[model samples]
Target: MVEFGALPLFLCVMGLFSESLCFVTLEVEVGDNVTIWCRHELIVSGYIHWFKHTCGSAPLIIGCKQFFGSVPSQNCFFFNESERMVVSVQGENTSLTITAVNVSDTGLYYCSSTDLMRITFHETNYLRVKGSESRRQSESAGF
Candidate 1:
């Protein structure tokens, strides 16, 4: 007979090495354009979700359901008005593009995908925006 007590432990161990979302940290200057890519290999029906996480605050949903399909069926909805934010998805590749990125856009961004089987994969990328010397100095001076 199979030991049911050890099944949960076995699954937990497997989950640790599950496939992870693929992305990289990005550093760009103000007004620069950048794209973050998220990739998954699972062949299950799923939806992709993007979020921006700021310090000491809840994550803000930047986009969702980024996939290749009809516009209404696979559309990205931005919680805030951001003319710079654009998202595109094709098969296993989902990318978020930011045009003319500003200082306020610097933060941690996450890309998550969940399939019908309830298996989820997610990755976080840190975006750093460089500012002018004056602005940096002012920030350092507590301004």
Candidate 2:
């Protein structure tokens, strides 16, 4: 697993090409868990990839799950069941779950699938993480 240390603020830019591209925006406070859902119509035959691409950083393959392939290999890559980042695929739906989200977790997540020699982009999500000002205030007030 790759770790991205403290980074600067991100500037998210998305270019629309076709109607098939799914774009979603989400907002969650720090320390909260967030789940991104990706739906695809293509029958998954090769590999399903979950990538996190920040503004200034290169795209990182945080999670992956392989389906029907000739070469026998691991089912998934990078994250396991207990990791903070987990990717689950069920039929035509796939989800990426991030637990205890923080400032650095903010970025544009992309879900894609590969079958044969073709790759299809399924969804793109822009996650915005808010600071825990309200949580701190509530703790100070002992609520």
Which candidate number maximizes TM-score? Answer: 2
* Candidate 2: C-alpha RMSD after superposition: 9.2
Candidate 1 per-residue lDDT over residues 1-143, each given as its tens digit: 22343243234334442223223568898889999887754354556777787666777878776443433326645444356787667767777899988888887776666555553445567787887953885689998
Which candidate number would show the highest lDDT if scored against the true structure? 2
| TM-score computed on alpha carbons, candidate 2 | 0.68
Summed backbone clashes in each candidate are 0, 0
Compared with the true structure, what per-residue lDDT tens digits does model 2 show for residues 13-73? 2433332333477989999999999875446367788888876678888888776533332
Reference-based lDDT, each prediction: 0.65, 0.69
**Whole-model lDDT, candidate 2?**
0.69
| True-vs-predicted CA distance for residue 114, candidate 2, Å | 0.6
- Clashing residue pairs for model 1: none
Model 1: lDDT equals 0.65
TM-score of each model, paired residue for residue: 0.66, 0.68
Misplaced by over 4 Å in model 2 are: 1-22, 42-44, 69-74, 77-82, 132-143
